[model samples]
Structure formats: C-alpha cells, structure tokens
Target chain A: MKADQTLDCIGLYCPIPIVKIATKIKDLKTGEILEVVGDDKGIKLDVPAWCQATGHELLGIEEQGGEIKVYVKKAPN
Target chain B: MAKKEKLTIAVLSGDLERALAAFMLAVTGASMDMEVSMFFTFWGLNIVKKNEGTMKSKGLMKKMLNMMNRGGSKRLKLSRFNMLGLGTWMMKDLMKQANMPSIDEYIAMAKDMGVELIACTTTCGVMGISPEKDSFRSEVGSLAGAAYFLSEARKSGVTLFI
Candidate 1:
C-alpha cells in the first residue's frame, strides 16, 4: 500500500516501536498515511491503541510471516 | 476529537524492575496523547535522587536504609534475585536484547512528552529525604501531598498505583 512514510521498527519491543511511531506520526502532514512494521509481541494491540488515543485513523492491520503491519492515517490537527 | 483520556500512575517502589515497569506504562500513556502524571512516593523517590548519599551514619537503621539507596537511580536493585547486583545486570541486558529503551531513556521521553513527575512530600519526610536538599531532577513537577494527588486522581479516568 502507498504510504507517505514507512517506519520500520522491527525487533524493537513494546513502547519503543510505539514511541517511534508516535514521534514519526507528528512529521506527516494532515491526511498523510503512515505505515509501520514491527515484530514486537505487543505491536498488534499497541498500534491500534495508539491510533485510538491519538485520534488517528487506523486503516488496516495485517500480519504475515510473523510480522505486523499497521496503516495509520494522520488526523487533522 | 473526543477529549483525551487522562491517566495517573502512582509509582510506589524504588526497585529498578518495578520502576521500569511503571515507567513503561507512563511513557505509553503519554504517547497516546493522555494527560499522564506519576506520583513518586516512599521508596519510589529513590529514582529521582540526585545526591548519591544522605545521612548514612545518623542511626543504625537509617544507616542501613541509606546503604540500600546510596546512589541515584543507578543503584536501584531488582525487587528480587538481586544477588550481588547480578539480577539488575541481567534485566538490563535483557532489555537491551529486546531493543527496549533504557530506563533513563524512558524517563526522559516521559518528561519530553509532558508527563508530570511529582514527589510525595510526606514520603520524603517520613523517609528522612529532604526534597529541597536531595537534588532531585528538575523534571519533578511538584513536591506535593496526598490531597493534591487525590484531587488529580479524582479528575482522572484511569488511575494506576504500581
């Protein structure tokens, strides 16, 4: 999928990947899409929860080959 | 957008393991756009101690307590299995292998994310820790009492006492 930016946080654990994602999301323009890939055990829940709390739109979450991919659309500030 | 949820984390342990665990929650909460704060009380105040040593030889018991918390956060031990400080080392290694941010890094991020770090005035007094002379980090939001924490928690949707 097309994304304004792709953040590869694979191998990073909880809070780090999410933290990186949170920091990167701020750099995107409103309506820009962010694609994040992480293999942390908690990434599945963490990504969506982050989106919910930050008022962003979680367009999709996919899992393949034991990796998690999350698509987030930047919310208008 | 709906009003962001507010979270209050009460860190009541000085153990490295527990303190790191609680900070993980605080950092995550703050990143999620929540209004997050932590009340550092009792033994937990050790994490913010700038001075390594206090009145060590004042009394036998106080001396022992001072020895247990002689240094800053670096001297913190795991709540259990702290054999010759090996347990603390093991945990840090594990955190490293897991690619988790170090405890210090998490605390710094929480500060940057605007997480309020409050030291309990009563705890400091009871523990003979002077908030003024202790030289805690400047990130500390306030030296406050239970009443103040209670008021904040009353307005918080999520309150966690770790």
Candidate 2:
C-alpha cells in the first residue's frame, strides 16, 4: 500500500518509537498509511503489538540492511 | 476543530530521570489538551510518597555514575542504586537545579489540569509502600496493577512507558 505519511523512528527504543507512532497515527485520517522505519530490534514486536491493541492494521513489516520498516494503515473506528 | 487527544503513561522505573520524564510528559499532555493518566509501579512509586524526603538528591559522584551507567537524562532509563537514600537525595538536588519540577509540583499540576495518577497496588503491596492518607495530591486515585493500566492504555491514542 502507498503511504500517505512516513515516520522515521530510527535509534529509538521500545516505548518512545511506539508512542511517537501512535501519536502520529492519531493525527492522520483513516485509511492513510504510516510507514515507520526504526533500528530497534524490539520494534519488530512492539509495533505489531501496538497496532493490534490500538485497532490499527499493520500492513507489512520488513527488515533490510539492519533496519526494520513497518507499514501501518489507520483503521476507521 | 482539532480533536482532543488522550495519552496514558505507565512509569515503572524508580529512577529519578524516569520520574522526571513522566512528569514532563504529564505536563505536556495536559498543556496540549490531552486526557492524561499516569500509572506508577515498581520503583516509580517512590515519587508518589507522602514524605517530602521520598524524592531527594544524591552526591556528585553518584550522579556522574548514574549518567555514565544509565546513558544520561534524555534516556529516561533506570539506574541501579546501592544506597537508595543518598542516591535519591542526589537525584532530587540535580533535578531541582536542572529546573525539573518536583513530584509534588507535577502532581499538583496534574491535578489542576485533570491528569490522573494511579499507583500500582500490587507493587505497593509487595514493596510495603502505603498510599493511604498520603500527601499525594487530592487528584491522585487508588492503586492499580499492570493489567488495569494496560487496559486503559489500550484505549488511549498515545501510551508511553517511561
């Protein structure tokens, strides 16, 4: 999916990046995709858990060259 | 119109830096018109103590050690304290000099701003920290556990663990 907004949370640990992403997503319209790039190994689990808990849809997750990319689509409530 | 936001922060570290971060976030959230709730657990509960001495300052050497070992203030992570009293004193002084608000001020601001403060019941029970009749701001509420805070956090637009 094409992202309407991209967020780079690289170098941030567990809760900071997640908090930042959540705050960002809250400001976006439903169906807008937020692409998150981070280097924290825990983001692999943190992002998905946050999406699941918050009712947002995690479109995809990929790791390349030591960086993890997450695509999340804001779900309309 | 801009929609109102909600943020719930679970601050479980007992470290002074983490406590300051939690307070800062609480203040910021309130300033932004966000409904904010903070859950204090584990060592984080120390800040909610009735006694003024609960959040004290430490010595320079210990402060330096904490900075070196815990990655400094911006990290907002915990530092291991061999002697809790001295460390707390040092931390309180350092935070004071840095213009960081006291726990009392944070709680008062939170109260005036409608921020919720929830102490972790289980941690308090296990650690023998009492919350009853405390000087904790009148806005402070009863204790809760991780599950309670997490459930509340799940409903918030922003949830932070500091």
Candidate 3:
C-alpha cells in the first residue's frame, strides 16, 4: 500500500470540513488512503456518517496530541 | 450494484435561516462531489429573488423570531422581512465580511458546480413572477410542481426540506 494522502480540515465548521475532505477524496485513485485531520467535535461522527453515506471506506480513526485523524480509503464502486 | 449517490434539497421556506442553511448544504454537497439540486418553492423562492431585501427584526419578539428563522420549517411563523433596520443591513455586511457568499452568488456557484436550481412554477405563477423578468437566470430549470420535486428527491441519497 502507498502512503496515505492527508487532508487537514481543522478550524472549519460543519459541512465545510466534510465538503473539503470529500472534494479531496474524489481526486484520489481507488485503494489510495486519505488521512483527514480535523478538530471539530462533530466530525468524529459527521465524517464517518458521510463516508458511509457516500460509499467511501473508513479504515480507522485515532487521536494523537489532541488532534483527530480519520483514515479513509477510496472504495471502488 | 453500486449506485451513484446524490443529494437533493427542497427549500420550501423563505426564512433567512432556512435559505442560509440550504445554501450551506448545497455548497457542501458540491464540494463533496455529489450531484446536488435545490428546489425553491413557496416562500423559499424569496431567497433567489433579485429584488428581495434582508430579513429584519424590530421588537424583542421580532428579534427572537429573526434568530429562529435560520432553518426552513413547514409551519414556521416568523416576522416579515425588515426593509428599514440597521440590524438587517449589519447582517448583510457581516455575511460579506465573513466570506459567506450571497444568495445570488450561491445560485451562480451552484450553476458553475453543476448543481441544479429548480423553481416552483406554481409559486411563481401565484406571485406573478416570470422567469423572463430581469435578474432571473436562464439557467434555472423550469418551474416544477411538488410531484416533480418529490420524484427527483426520491432518487437522491439525502433529501432536505429546508
């Protein structure tokens, strides 16, 4: 597997962070992983819900030094 | 089979909160690479009107109503648009300074982003507004009825009535 692509979405509000991440993931090739970084408390649920709704795969989620990181893989349809 | 997922938002309220929320959702949906559509009907069409003024509040009760007008509600009874208030003017200026696009800008952005804007024909006819009138964009789809809007909503992965 290649190194995951990272998307920093900190400081943005609801929908904006999700929107930015979605836009970034669309340009990536299938099987490529995306690392989404954000601090929105809502994103902890919002991102996963969005990924599930849009058919994207959520690989993992972790917290490091107070920042939240979401791992997503572009799933093939 | 994996089906393409899209979102369609039906804006049926003309409240400021509803309009802003719908615009935000549309911008977000487009950014998400989802095909999004906004159906403007009833008072909701006011947001798209070129001549419409900003929402305003006068008394304490009215101010409370103004703050509550963010999201479209099926039966929300709020104060009318404030045509002569510093608050309304301030709100517009604040939105501009915040880098938030105006309703008109959002409509144009939606077009550029391939988001569909559908006007309700029934409402337009009742209000005596014509699509050919000045300031209305030709890119707006035909005035559709509730049935048509609902049909499109059924195909969308997420549908919002704002």
**Per-model DockQ against the true two-chain complex:** 0.75, 0.03, 0.29
Steric collisions counted per model: 0, 11, 3
lDDT of 3 by residue, B1-162 (tens): 555568899887776656767878887787656788889876776665554332343456534543443222222223455455445556667767655566566666667778888888776644445433332355465567789888888888899988
Candidate 2 residue lDDT tens string, A1-75: 478998988766545576578668878899889999988888898777767656789999989999999999988
Say which candidate scores most in DockQ. Answer: 1
| Candidate 3 displacement at residue B51 in angstroms | 5.6
- The parts of candidate 1 lying over 4 Å away from their true place are B51-68
On the 0 to 100 scale, the lDDT of residue B36 in model 1 is 92
Please give the TM-score for the first chain of candidate 2: 0.93
Q: Give the Cα error of residue B26 in candidate 1, in Å.
A: 0.6
Question: CA lDDT of A54 in candidate 1?
Answer: 84
* Candidate 2 TM-score, true structure as reference: 0.49
Interface RMSD of each: 1.6, 8.2, 3.3
lDDT of 2 by residue, B57-129 (tens): 2556534533343321222333655264566677667766655566666667667767888888776544454
lDDT by residue (B8-71, candidate 1, tens digit) is 9888888888889888888888888888989999888888766443543345665676566564
lDDT of 3 by residue, A1-77 (tens): 23468888776557667767877887889989998888767778988888876778888888877688888889885
Error of 2 at B95 (Å): 4.9
**Per-residue lDDT of candidate 1, residues A1-77 (tens digit):** 78999999988888888778888999999999999988876888888888878889999988899888899999998
Better TM-score candidate (1, 2): 1
**Candidate 1 TM-score for chain A:** 0.94
